[model samples]
Target: MHLSNQGLLVILVVGVVAGWLAGRVMAGGGFGLIGDLLVGLVGAFIGDWLMPQLGIHLGVGIVALIINAFIGAVVLLLILRLIGGGFGGRRRWI
Candidate 1:
């Protein structure tokens, strides 16, 4: 569904908060505002895409959004680590 500007803003706020929470939980540390928001937004999309492929279906709503955000944040963190060449001495993805 298409979101109006206000609706999109609200969604973005929620996504950002969700992402921050997820990042804190996964990383055991704080991810500042912008970082959390970006991760959350990306996480939302990643979670939505990856879950279906993994046979995990979450109904749409706050819970699903949060789940998606968390998954996305985790994946983002992993990617960031790999990109920074900090994957514990493992080969980088790129």
Candidate 2:
């Protein structure tokens, strides 16, 4: 399919916002512009798929989209941390 310019813009904005929000909440700060955008975009995909599986729907709208992405981003960050990616670089023993 084809996506309009406006649609693409909206996706970028949402990804940035969601990524920043998740970084701040999980990492206690933003992960720069590019980092935030990447995290958000990947998170958006996770949220879009995981949300429905867990029976969690935030309705429809820009706000809902952001919420979904934010949730997904948080989850992503948490997973990364558990795997010792950004969790103080400490190796977990368990």
lDDT of each: 0.75, 0.91
Candidate 2 per-residue lDDT over residues 15-35, each given as its tens digit: 999999998898556778999
TM-score attained by model 2: 0.88
**Poorest 10 consecutive residues by lDDT, candidate 2:** 84-93
The C-alpha TM-scores of every prediction are 0.74, 0.88
**What local lDDT score does residue 47 receive in model 1, on the 0 to 100 scale?**
80
Total backbone collisions for each predicted model: 1, 0
Error of 2 at 12 (Å): 0.3
Name the candidate that leads on lDDT. Answer: 2
lDDT of 1 by residue, 1-94 (tens): 8779987886687678777787666654545778778878887888878888899887887777787777877887778767875433455478
